[model samples]
Target chain A: MIRAEKIFKNFGDQAVLKGIDFTFEAGKTNLVIGKSGSGKTVLLKILVGLFQPTSGNIWYSDINLVSADKESLRKLRMEVGMLFQGNALFDSMTIEENIRFPLDMFTTKTLKEKKDRVNYCLERVSLEGNNNKFPSEISGGMQKRVGIARAIVLNPKYLFCDEPNSGLDPQTSITIDELILNITKDNKITTIINTHDMNSVMEIGENICLLDKGKLAWQGSKDEVLISKNEVLHDFIFASPFLQKLIENSK
Target chain B: MNLNLFYHFGNFVIWQAQIFKRPENGSMYYKETVRQMYDIGIGSLPIVFLISIFIGAVTAVQFYYQMAGSLIPAYYIGYIVRDMTIIELAPTITCLVLAGKVGSNMAAEIGGMRQKEHIDAMEIMGVNTSAYLILPKLIASLLMIPILVCAAALIGILGAYIASVPAGLFSSAEFIKGVRSFFIPYNVIMMLVKAFVFAYILTGVSCYQGYFVKGGSIELGQASTRAVVYSNILILLADYIIALILTA
Candidate 1:
């Protein structure tokens, strides 16, 4: 589990996150949903230790991530996996090389063992037999899966995905969401996703935190999304007239 | 101005400390250093060769003109060219050219990675990105730049021979005699010291500019430009300082 207590992040005079407090539960798909400029990315970056909160404490289970020393932070990083918005695969490296990078850097596995592990990770992401392909040669969805393969090759205890479904088609997006959800359940790892996809919220959002203008405006499950009386949530989620009409007709 | 200089100086010092941290994998660093060595040394050879040849030719021609009416021996032209190329021109000019070519390239490459979030990816993976990215380049430049400067010095002498001997500015024997005359080995030492110092300045300043880059493509381009500009300026500055200290 990861906990953020009274998190505040500022950029110059502009505040990006204001006193956010939340618990991301383990063995579950936790989603942070917000509109543009709602501090979702900043909050996610802070949670992943890419950004430091101006005032707050972040706890990874019993470890205080905020105060962890360099060595401790490195140990913590070994347990953390992140899938970036752009996939962040080394373009010059083949998929197999990319997937095996962390293992190569951190582990003393023999060549055959490393190759076997890379193959297993590729198969887990359904990217088997594509090991020799470069990132540009594959589709965006495949690249994201390769990114996931690389992220989980280390078998991290915590996984974070930023805008995982941003550039995928609806069908592909559903597949990615299902992949993340299944991985979270299978590994019982704490998984946090930053997304604006409503389908993701309704499908895999077992626990959701909604940020509005850098503040937590709503928190609930998918079950409460349609029934909630929160005007901001309603306006933001069903901003399209068609979605609003569909919800009204359903009611 | 002083405060700004102090600010960057402090940051550069801290950045060096980060870059010298223990490597996560020694073999990986070795492979990267070899790659960097090939890129910096072999990839840079053609341009360095082209420039050094011309520098030798121009120095010979200009000095020949100056020596034409003077009572100074025609052989002195070869001696002057040989000494100038060995003591100053080859190392300094070759490095300045590399400061533009290799330095800007390192800046753009690293700055692009930062913009693309590749550095963050490595950092999150328990990798000390500063060390991983910069150390190999440093090692490669330290080893390769001196070799390149040496090659540049030899080629420059050959260039002086080609220009002066073919142009009939002096007899081949006189030119050869002049080159063989007044050979001070310490001048070779001075040249090498300048090469090492300039190599460090260019690579360090370039890596520093790129590693801390922020914002988007526009900012990345600006960082690359700054890398080249700052490296050239610093290399020249170091050249002057080394010359003063060594020559004095």
Candidate 2:
């Protein structure tokens, strides 16, 4: 479980995340949705402790991330796995090395043990023989799959993904969303995904928090979100003509 | 200009220092340093040696030509090679060669990592980016470079001799005498010390440039350029400082 209280973030004088608050429950996918520059990425970074919040505190379970020291941050980090927007796999290393990197850095596993675990994760992601291949040798979707494998390789207590479906085709994006949902349920790990994909929201969002211009517009399940007549939330949800027509037709 | 250059300098130093502060980071940092030394120091030996030798030989040939009409002896070629290798080629030219090779490699590696946001990833993973990345490299350069310089001086003098012997100047004995006649023990020691300083400067400056780089691949290229540029300038400046100290 994770909670953010009154998180304020700024880039110089430009406020990005302005006094936002939300809590993510364990054993489910918590989706943070916002348009570009709506402070989704800023909030995600604060949650992961990548960027210091201008003012606020983030709690992972009971530990206050804002006041945590280096050791505490490191322990949280070890328990956390992040799937970056671009995969961010080490270009110089092969897939196996990339997947096993957290193990190498944080675990006391022998090389043989690490290799076995890497193979297991690679197999779980349906990427068995591809371990020998470099990042360039793989397709975009495959790379994303590898990124997912790397994220869950540590069997982390928490997973954070930033724009995981950013550049993929719709079908592939849905597949990724399903994969994430399956993984979240399978591992029973608290997962937070920062996304703008409405399809993903409709498909796999167990919990959804909408942000608008550095403020939390709404926080609830998809069912609640669909019935809520909050004009701001409706504007965001029905911004596209296709979705607007769907909402009108549903009524 | 009141640009606060010292503060910037101190900040950079502190950033570098912070990398070496963590206990969990030590093994990797040490391993990286060893790998770098192997790459920068051991891998570079052949090139540095070949150049030193060629320079030594040419210096002897040039000495033969210059001293031809003079009262100076033929074995003076040895003296020329020895002085040039100890004072200039071993420390200065060796450092320059390494800057092109290892310094550039350091910049490119760290620069590429920066471009990929690997450093940010490391930080988010709660690893001290500096300790995991920079300390290994700096220590590697420091430990291995002086050994390389010593090789450069020794091989370079031999190369000079190999060239001179064919010219019918200085029988082996006479050449040996020429090298020793004006040999100052301190000069050899000075070259070693200078090479160590050069190694540290090259590694530190290159890594620093790469670490703070913004933007993407183009910015990494810029960091590499800055690494080479700043490293070259510093090497020359350090040479003068070493010279001033030795002479004084």
lDDT per model vs. reference:
0.93, 0.86
List runs of model 2 lying over 4 Å from the truth. A241-251, B1-4, B23-31, B168-173
Q: What is the TM-score of chain A alone in each candidate?
A: 0.97, 0.96
TM-score of each: 0.98, 0.92
What i-RMS does every model get? 0.7, 1.6
lDDT of 1 by residue, A120-196 (tens): 98998999999899999999999999999999999999999999998999999999999999899998999999999
lDDT of 2 by residue, A70-178 (tens): 6787888888888899888888889998888777777788899999999998888888999899999999989999999988888988989999899999999998999
For model 1, name the residue pairs that clash. none
**lDDT of candidate 1 at residue A170, scale 0 to 100:** 92
TM-score of chain A of 2: 0.96
Error of 2 at B129 (Å): 2.2
Give the per-residue Cα lDDT of candidate 1 at A34.
Answer: 91
* DockQ agreement of candidate 1 with the native complex: 0.89
By DockQ, who's the top model here? Answer: 1
